[model samples]
Structure formats: C-alpha cells, structure tokens
Target: MDYIIKNEKLKLIYEPGKGAWTYHLRIPNSEHIEGKWGEIKVSGSIDDYKLESRNLALTKEGDKILSINNEIRTAINKKGGEGSNFNAYSQCSINCNFSLSVAIL
Candidate 1:
C-alpha cells in the first residue's frame, strides 16, 4: 500500500515493507522533473520556490533544510499514534516546511 503525504507543492510517497518503509519525497528543484519514458515527473512553481527562499530557517542555506526535514520526519513518526503500528504518514511535515519557508514579500 501507499501512504501519501503532502501540503501544497511538496509531497512524500511512503511504501512500507516487512520491516522498513521506502520513502519518495517530491522536492522543488531548479530543473523541473519531467514525465517521459515512465519516469516519475518532478515539478514545482517558481512562486513556491521564492517563498521557500524567504524562510528564516533557510535564509542562509546551510543545514536548515536538513534540520527541517528531520523535524518533519520526527513529527511524521509521532503522528501515527502510540499503538496503531505507527506506520502511517502525515502531510503535516509539508506544512511545517512551508511555514518555515514562507516569503516575507
């Protein structure tokens, strides 16, 4: 089964195996991911990218993205509840990322 999580532009696709989960995150890139030959298409809006550029966390462009991503990961792990296998996914991560990346202008 697929556990899909997303907010606005970014999205994550999670596939759970017997003991592990495979993750596919759709992130904005300078070059858009195109669809052809069955390859997964990656795309983003410039406005969104610009907005992300304004995030206080990402202002300097160091490890903030990594930090943010980790925070999101942690949040996602916590979202599935305490006893329900905890194998679900959450789009809250995306919102967190977006909020951390919103533009001032």
Candidate 2:
C-alpha cells in the first residue's frame, strides 16, 4: 500500500512495498516531482572505494514525517584500501510542513 503525508504546502506519497520509493512530491502551485526509480539514491565511497545502498528500512513520525534508513554493504574493491571493510548506515528524514525540511544523517 502507498503511504501519504501532507501539510499546508506539501504532500508526499511513499511506496513502502517498492523499497520505500517516493511516488510523488507535490507542492502547492508547482509541478510535482515524480520518482521512477525511487527518489533517494545515495552513493559514495568507502575507504576511497565506491559503495552503494543495499537495503532500506522506513519509519513514520506522527502525520507529517517519514524516516528512511539505508544499510550499505558489499564494498567495491579498489586501489588504496584504508583499513577493513565495514557496514554503513544512513538515515533520511522527510518532513512535510509549512516550512519543509529534509535531513540526511
């Protein structure tokens, strides 16, 4: 099922069944920002090696916020290994309000 949260100025539709993908981002008097392959895509390097998201977990905060936590593993081997391979966790918080805010931790 799709999850939804909205406020005075914004609305968000999230598809938890599809890896918690963002289905639609709506703003008043503006065109909607749609997502085809999920809205949040996180990519970075671990020990100078490329790393990518492997899994995700979602949590809802009240009626206007959604929290998505990403777990990353499967290190991509590259030159210059810093130390040892490890797992990484990232949290993305989406808030819908008059003053909207998005935070990645």
Candidate 3:
C-alpha cells in the first residue's frame, strides 16, 4: 500500500517497501512529474546489501509538515512465502540497525 501526504497545492506518495521511495508527486490540477521520483539511499561496506523499511508510522501530520518514520534493516536472508508482499516481512528476518525519519514541508 502507498501512504499519501498532501496539501492544497501538492501531493506525494511514499512507498516504504520499495527502497523508501516517493513514487508519485503532483501538483493540483496537473499531471504527476513524469520520470521523476524520490528515494533514500543508505550505503556501507557491503556493496550488494539491500535496504528495507520497517515499522512505518505517521508520527505527525499538520498544516506545515508531515513526518514519517521507519526502522531500516538490511536483508541478510529471505524466505519466500504466500502472504502480503510488504517489505516488513523481509525486515523480520534481520535486526534493525538504522532509523530514518522524514519530514516533508
């Protein structure tokens, strides 16, 4: 599922499961900015490590800002299962060593 943050002039869709990406952005009465999106990148020693977002919560929502938080983890292993395709499942197999909080204004 996608989380939406919006105000009178703009709208944003945050997709934590896909690399903590802001997958959609638009201004009112206008088309979404084609080919443009946002993402958060975390890197370290392991070049092939994958980052996943967990414990996503909307900590704040106000006229001036929107705050979202996630416990970030790198998937060391994964087990394919028959269930919802949320990335939190991948995070369940690892320990969270990073935290990310995003505030949009």
User: lDDT of all the models against the reference?
Assistant: 0.25, 0.28, 0.24
TM values, all candidates:
0.21, 0.21, 0.16
Q: State the lDDT of candidate 3 residue by residue for 1-105, as single tens digits.
A: 122221222223455554433332212221211211122222221113333432222212311211122321123222211111121111222332232222211
Between candidates 2 and 3, the lDDT winner: 2
Ranking of all candidate structures by their lDDT, best first: 2, 1, 3
Write model 2 residue lDDT over 1-105, tens digit each, in one string.
111212222323444564434332222321121222233222333334444642222223212222222321133322221122322332223321122222111
Clashes of each: 1, 0, 0
Candidate 3 has which clashing residue pairs, if any? none
Q: Which regions of candidate 2 deviate over 4 angstroms?
A: 1-37, 52-57, 61-105
Report the number of the highest-TM-score candidate: 2
* Model 1: per-residue Cα lDDT over 12-70, one tens digit each: 43445512223332233312212222232112222222112212122122222211233
Estimate the Cα RMSD of every predicted model relative to the unseen true structure. 15.3, 14.2, 15.4
TM-score between candidate 2 and the true structure: 0.21
Window of ten residues with lowest summed lDDT in model 3: 81-90
Candidate 1 steric clashes = 1
